[model samples]
Structures are given as C-alpha cells and as structure tokens.
Target chain A: MVRWEPGTAERLQKVALELFATRGYEQTTAAEIAQAVGLTERTFFRHFSDKREVLFQGQELLVQAFLDGIEAAPEDASPFEVVACALRSAATFFPDERRPHSRTRQSVIDRNPALQEREHHKLTTLATTVATALRARGVDDVAATLAAESGATVFGIAFTRWLREERSLADIAAEVLAELLTLAARALRPAR
Target chain B: MVRWEPGTAERLQKVALELFATRGYEQTTAAEIAQAVGLTERTFFRHFSDKREVLFQGQELLVQAFLDGIEAAPEDASPFEVVACALRSAATFFPDERRPHSRTRQSVIDRNPALQEREHHKLTTLATTVATALRARGVDDVAATLAAESGATVFGIAFTRWLREERSLADIAAEVLAELLTLAARALRPAR
Candidate 1:
C-alpha cells in the first residue's frame, strides 16, 4: 500500500480546480492533475476515483459539517432551530479564505453540465442525510424532511449569492433562511 | 420519417415499467419493451432515446402540469399561494388510476441507483422550472426560488405518502404544504 501523505488530497483538489478552470474541464486529465501536484497517477487515483471525484472532494466533510451542527444544537431545540445550527456550522466549513477556491470550483461546475448534475446530487444527498439526522433527534418525519430540504435549498441559493457578493457564507445563509421563512409565511389564495 | 402513433409512448412506458418490475430493470431491453407493445425497436427509439428514458417519459408533462398550475393561479397570488396552485395542479397529473403505475415506477427506481439519481435530477429540474415560472409572474428571485423549492419538496413527500396511503395526491400535498409552513414558523434557538 502507498503511504498516505498528509494534505495530499487538499493540495490535489486545489491544483485540479485551477487546472479545470484554466484548461477547461473536458480538456484536463487526471494524470495531468497528478503530474501538476508532483504525484503519480496511482496516487491520484488513491485519493479520488476520477477527475470528477477530485472536484467533489470534501463533499463528505461538508455533509458532516451540517450534521455536526445538528449534533451541536441544544437538545430541546425545535426542528428549525436544529437546522439553523446545522447551517451555521456548515457555513464555518467555508470560511473567507475558501471563497476564492469555492468561486473557482463553482465556475468550473457551471461550465460543465455533468458537474452541475453531480453538484445537484451532492445537495440532494446532503438533504437526505440531514433529514435522517433530524429524525434521529425525535423530530417527526414530515417536519424533519421539510426542515432539512429547506436548509439545503437555503444553502444552495446563499452559496450561489456568496460567490457573487462580498458577504460571508454564514451571513448570506442566514438571510436566505429568513427570506425562505418569510415566503413560507405568506398566505396562499383560496383554491378555485 | 415513420408515422407517429398517438398512444405509443404511453403504452411503451406502461409496458416498460411492468417489465422492469417483474423481469428486473437490468434484464429488460428497449427492444423487448417495444415488441411487447407490438411495435418495432425503431419506433421505441423514436419515442424515447433509450430504455432509461422510457421510465421518465412523463417528466415533461409533469413539469408542464406545475407550470400550468402557476399559470392558473390568481394574478395577485402570493409566492406561497402560487406554489400551492402549482402543487395542486401537479397532483392532478397523478390521479388514482396512475398510482399503481407510479408505485411500480418508484419501486424500479428504488432498486436501481442510476434510476434514483435520474429521478432526483428530474425533481431538481422541476424546482428550477417552477422557480423560473414564479419569476416570470413578477415574484422576486429569492421568494421565487424558496417557494419553488419548497413546493417541490412538498410534492415529493406527498407523492411518497400517496403511494402508501389511500388519500388523493392533492389532499396529501395540501397537508404537506401546511405542515411545512408550520415547521418554517417554528422559533430557532439563539446561535452559539
């Protein structure tokens, strides 16, 4: 077995994003990314299943951050409260220093339909995982699902805005959550 | 070009779902589905790009139902109200007669990871399309997105329940929407 190198995945992901952004996702190769990071192709494959997997590196950690937030919430917190904590915790996963990296990563994904689909799949997974976590907290099925889905939607919209705006992800996510609540509270017209 | 058959697509979809459930989705072939429906393989290709596409045959119509719901709403309806209309409209697309079909279709998807991914993608597309329709109706971007996403979530949850319960899709969807609003209104604990 090849000895694992600390920070190897992070370094490779950074280099891969840069290459994907500059050379076009379709034109770049996993071998090229490995070479750029001064690593062998086998080592790159060790860290990621493919070039696409490299771009999606840290997806598990992102989901964990949200889950961690849920775990860190008050024992008696409401479903929305638990989700808020989870979102806030998730926000910390993307600090100011990571903004440029995220921007570049998102730009690369935006240019590729497959990447966009993968990103959407990631968010869907995040929602389901979070919902399961919420249910574990004794939140009922429907409430847990709705809150978790709402949180994922808020994160997605806020993350997109954060890429363009100067606001912090946490702040943007909070605002998005508030707006979602406001929209949800709006009265619907009577069914004809 | 071969002459179009009015009910060819629907008939093929029904037969494909039946075959996928009994014969196994992996074991079934597009040619078999077409032949079962008394048509040529070329006709099958004409209606659907491939076997996978056969399962998602009504995706466009489902999306159109949501849009039609938005269009049918009152001109001055609020964002949530507009989504309610859309969900109600969409529910009509899956009447009682369609439940068995949907149940079989969902079972096939549940057994196959690829079909599950495609189903998730379809729902994502539906959310984006509904959001765009909301925007075109003069709703702000954030409200439109939040409402559209929320609407999709409700539809998903209700659809799952509709498959198991005897209640109508529209009723289940309405209850789900109301429950979502109640969850959204719950108080959040102070951040740490």
Candidate 2:
C-alpha cells in the first residue's frame, strides 16, 4: 500500500496539467504524469482515476459551495436570487491565481471532443444539483429547473468571459445574471 | 450508387427506434436495424452514419425552423421575442403523432451515457444557432447569448414536460417561457 502523502493529489494535478498543456492531452500518459510527480502509477490511481480527472477534481467542492449557498440564503429569496447567490458563492472556489490554469485547461478541453462532452456533462450535473437544492427550498419543478439551468448558463458565460477578461468571477457572474434579467424583462414585455 | 428510395430513412429510423426500445440500445446493432427494415447495411449507411444518427435526424429540420422563424419575425421584434417565436415555430416539428416516438427516443437516450452526451451537444448546437440568428438580427453578443441560452433552457423544460403531460407543445413552451419571465421579474426585484 502507498504511504499517505499530504500534497500528492495537488502535485500530481499540477504536473499532469503542465504535461497536458505542453505535450497535449492525447500525447500524455498516466505513467508519465505519475513519474513527473515522482510517484508510482498505483499512487496516481489512488488519487485520480485517470489523467482527465485532474481537471475535474474541483467539481465536488464547487457543487457543495453552491448547495450550501442556496440552503443558507434568506427563506424569502426568489428562485433566481437563490440561484444567483449559489453561483456567486461557488465563484469563490476559483481564485484569480487559478485563472491561468483554467485557461490552459479550457484550451485543452476545447481541442478534444471527449473532453468537451465531459465538460457538457459536468455542467448538466451541476444544473441538476442546483435544481435539487432548489426543490429542497420549496421551489416547484419548473421553477427549480428554470432557475438552476439559468444559473448554470450565467455561470458558464461568466466563466468564459472571466477566463479572457480581468474581472473577478463574482462580478462577472453578477453582471451576467443582471443581463439575463434584463433580457427576460424585455422578453416578458407585451407585444407592441 | 444506391438508388434514391422514398421513405427509406424514415423506415430505418422507425425500425431502429423500435429495436432500441424493445431490445435495448446497446443490444440493438446497426445491422439488426438495417435487417429489420428489409434493407441492406449499405442502404442504412446511406441514410445515417451510425445507429445514433437515427435518433438525431430531426435536429437539422428543427434548427432550420428556428432560423427561419427568427429571420421571419417582424423587424422590430426583440431578441427574446425572436427566440420565443422561433421556439414556438419549432413546436410544429413535434406534432402530437411524434410524441410516442420522442418518448421512446428519450428513454433510450437517458439510459445511455453516450446518447446523453450527444443530446447535450445537440442542445448546445441549438443554442449557438439561435445566438447566431439573434446576432444576425442586430442583437448584441451578450444579450443574444442570454436570449439564445434562455430559449434553449425553456425548450428543454417544455419539451420534457410535453413528453409526459397532455398539453400541446406550444402551450407548454409558452407557459415555461412565461414562468421564466416571472422568475426573472421576482429576482430582479430589490431584496426586502
């Protein structure tokens, strides 16, 4: 059995991401990632199932943040407000220091169809998690789904822009949420 | 070259879906689908690249309907109005007669990860297409994306319910859109 290591996972993720960025995700192998971090292949498997999982390690933490934020919001909060708050809370998971890594990770994902599909699936899961959280908050099915999906959309748009622009994730998310609300207002206006 | 055959693609899709529903998607093979339709495998290849394409054949027509609806909307229509109109127009693509087929298709897709990923990709493509149409109508990027993504979200919610509920697709879609607008309104209101 491999001995317990404090930063093994983080070290592995860093080395794997660098390798993926330099040599391409397809060109990189799990053994190379493990060796780069001075760990055995078995040790790498103990931390991550595969090389692709390094980029997705934070998904669970992000989901927890979203759920906690939603559950902690005021009882009177609107569905959209709860969603917005949850997204804003989740934004804390991605520090500005991680932006460069995120940009590289996204570039890698964009080049690979499998990664793109995984990313889409991740987003879908995130939306479903948020929807479930909303339902727990007494929101109905349609409203919960709408709010959760809308929040996920706002998060995606903001995350994309945030990767390219010099803005805080929270600010970007807030701006996108407001923009969506404005569009929704315009759409709701009675036909002239 | 294989001679053009009337309704061959439809017949193949019908057989493929039936086989998928009864025998399971993974258990159903392309050869089996072709054989069931009384056609050679080569003939099946002429219509669909693979078994999955049989389920996604309507995507193109739906996209076209969305584009056409956006293009034909009154020049003064808002981005959201154009999207709402486009979705309403696309509803005609899913006539009542097609509901049973769609239900079966969705069940097959839900049980398979690959099919689910394809469905998500298809939705993403639909959103992108709607965004492009809105941009062509002089809508700004951010607003167009918001409207387009929102429209896709509404379509997903409405379509899911329409599959299980007795209401017409158009009515369900309109109601979901209205519900989203209402949620947006409440979220836009200042916190008490």
lDDT of each: 0.88, 0.87
lDDT of 2 by residue, A52-121 (tens): 8987886887888888889878899999999888987888887787798899889889989889878878
| Clashes by residue pair, model 2 | none
Chain A TM-score by candidate, in order: 0.91, 0.95
Lowest-lDDT window of 10 residues in candidate 2 chain A? A1-10
Show how many residue pairs clash in every candidate, following the order shown.
Answer: 0, 0
What is the lDDT, from 0 to 100, of the residue A109 in candidate 2?
93
The local lDDT score (0 to 100) that residue B182 gets in candidate 1 is 76
Write model 1 residue lDDT over A74-129, tens digit each, in one string.
99888888888899999888777678988999899999998898898888899999
